[model samples]
Target: MKKITALIGSAQKKATYEAVREFERNLKSHTEIELEYVFLADYQIEFCRGCKLCFNQGEKFCPLHDDRDLIIDKLIHSDGVIFATPNYAFHVSASMKNLLDRTAFFLHRPYFFGKAFTSIVTQGIYGGNSIIKYLKNMGENLGYSTSKGCVLKTLEPVTKDVQKKNSLKIKKAAARFNKVLMRQTAPSPSFFRLMMFRMSRSSMKEMLNDEYYDYQYYRKNGWFESDYYYEVSLNPIKKMMGRIFDYIGHRMAGMN
Candidate 1:
């Protein structure tokens, strides 16, 4: 039996809870695989301090000892990790964010090195794709073999129609994840480590150089800098003024 750990990352509330319940219903279809569910709402996790203790100083333990340790242990022991969350503001909920922050404990740990991962994201409005992409990127960064993602958008009170659609998607995603986990072969650590190190360096440089850094670079390249700021500063005011004019015109037309 393949051991699988599913991390339920939504904050325990009405809509998110409903989505979770629906997902659970779908998961039951696969009775052959041994499954365990870990809920983030039940635990108290702290923000990562950026201490780098797991990699730089200590014996691979996160600086803040909290519920994250147990979660990490479960993930390490499992052959597959399934991340499920509700999309909030085009990303994951606060609970999911906090849990992600805690994963710093396993920065250099071999437990998550090349383990299979699948993501399931539910969004009330738009932007489910963004949330799925974000989780998938994180999974890959942690040396997890990522499977196909599951996305749900515009979910309200869980109706039977929505449930049926999501059930099939979740079941298929879980099956695919299990198949990858059952594969005995794992990725090479030394090669992955070197590639990850290089990627990190490049990504860090790009991140540190945001708008301000871009402005500087463009200025150096003889691109007029003041014009860029002028456009950025004027666009919002222009949009606001345009809306005001449109509203006034509509009222005037109604009066006529």
Candidate 2:
């Protein structure tokens, strides 16, 4: 059975959780996917120190030893991830931001692949699209297949009409998610994703020391030679483009 981790970035289980729960319920109807819920507010994550330990040395070398590893482990083991948050000031909430900040190192050394991602955003009326877009971009960087996302208008008091609309939308989104999640094979990376892989891997291999965790990770994963993070067929033109990107990235890192 596929496991899906639903992480709520709200301070409390209020509107955001409500929207996530609705999504879970709808997803369940389509399939028997196991669901795990992570309330970020309950985790003891410390603020990112900007010391670059996680980026340069390794995540294990981070100064703060909170629930970061535990959370990451949960995510790594899951087949799919659902990030839910309340829109704040036209973006994700602080709780969600904290989680992202702590795991920012993954942008440099992505590990997750062949995983599905869907985001849920609850807002009073506006900015849900922006927050959902942010999470989708994160998923893309982490090697995940992302759905467009689910946005629900959650004004105060929660009217019946709103709930009805939310349920309908959630079910529609879940159907699309489930269909993609159940696919037997993974798709090849987009040209943009290939460029990212080329740039990041070349930069790390050229600039980082052997002892640096990011460099070691690249070696361990054989990313230096692999065309992309995951196995897939690539056309010749795309391969040439990736080569160009890698050469540029190496030159840029060499100059730094």
Candidate 3:
């Protein structure tokens, strides 16, 4: 059975967490996937100190050590990841953002590959959808196969219509998440994704070798010689775009 986890980003077990539980219940009932819930409030993740060590050197060089690795381990071991959060002032709560901030290096050196990711967001009034959008982008940065997220309204005086709508949305999102998690392989990288790999690898190879761990990582992963993060059949246009990105990288290197 595939392992799944919901990283809860709130401090209280409020209506926000209830929405996440609804997602888990639906997913569990539909599939054989093993599910776990992780509350970031329970972890001792320190605030990022802006040292840039994780990007410049390596994660091991990060200044403030805490449960960051433990969180990452949960992420790595899970086949599917769900980021559950209560929108706080129109954004993800500090707990969720802190986790993302700590994993900023992954944005450059993605490794999750075929793992699936989605979001379950709850809000009192507005911003739940926007928060889910942010989660989708972050999931991609971490190299997870992202799916459409679920947005739920948790304001008081719950109307019958609102509750019914949330139930449908929860079921729909769970079904989508389940389907993607069952997909054993990651989807083909898009043109922009390919360009990102080409530009970063080339820039690191030509410059920044002594400045960032990504340079060594690209070399070790053989990404310097490849067109995408993983092997995939690329169409002619995307291949051409990749070469153009490489040319741009060369130009940037020439300027250095």
Candidate 4:
């Protein structure tokens, strides 16, 4: 069975938690999955201290001793991952933001390539859409093939109509997430992802050395020479675009 983990940020068993449960059920209707719910409140993830040790050296060098790696291990072992959070004060809950902040180095050295990712955001009113977008982008940066996530307006005293609507939204999002999870082949990189890889690799190659963890990681992964993160046939046009992006990256690196 495929392993899917939902990292839920809410401390309470409320809208966000319920939404993830509904999502799990809907996803299982498509295929059998071993779903695990990780309540962030149950873990001891310390707030990030803004020390760049994880960036400059390695994540192991990070000073705080906590469960960050344990959570990351769960993500690494799962076939799919979900970030579920409630919108608090127009943003993701503190727990969710703290997790993201602690793992910010992943943005520099992404490690979850080919994993399926999506988000579930429950909100009282107007901010859930933006939270979904933020989580999706973060997933992509972490190297997951992300499905566009959903936002459910879950104002208190949710009427039956609201529950029904949220269920439909969850169902649709689960279907999309399941489809990505069941794909037989690696997804081809989109043009934007292609550009991101080419530009980042080029800039790192030009500007950094072995002293930097990011540089060492790119070298170890052979990203400096690879056409993309994984081998896929790129059309001639994209190949040309990749080279152009490389040139632009080189120029940018030189200017810094």
How do the candidates rank by lDDT, highest first? Answer: 4, 3, 2, 1
Off by over 4 Å in 1: 13-31, 59-62, 105-111, 187-194, 197-256
Model 3 lDDT per residue over 32-59, tens place: 8788889999999999999888987899
Per-residue lDDT of 1-256 in model 2, one digit per residue for the tens? 8899998888878888877777888888888989988998898998888999888788888999889899999999999999888889998888788888999888887767778888989989887887878899998887788888889988888899988998888888888888778877888788888888899888887887788888888888888899988788889999899999999999999999
TM-score of each: 0.65, 0.94, 0.95, 0.98
Q: What lDDT does candidate 2 reach at residue 7?
A: 89
Which wins on TM-score, candidate 2 or candidate 3? Answer: 3
Candidate 3: where is the Cα deviation over 4 Å?
A: none
lDDT of 3 at 229: 84
Clashing pairs in 4: none
Steric clash pairs (candidate 3):
none
CA lDDT scores, all candidates in order = 0.62, 0.87, 0.87, 0.92
TM-score of 1: 0.65
- Give me the runs in candidate 2 sitting further than 4 Å from their true place: none
Superposed on all Cα atoms, the candidates' RMSDs to the truth, in angstroms, are: 16.1, 1.6, 1.4, 0.9
Q: List the lowest-lDDT window of 10 residues for candidate 2.
A: 106-115
In terms of TM-score, the best-performing candidate is: 4
Model 1 lDDT on a 0 to 1 scale? 0.62
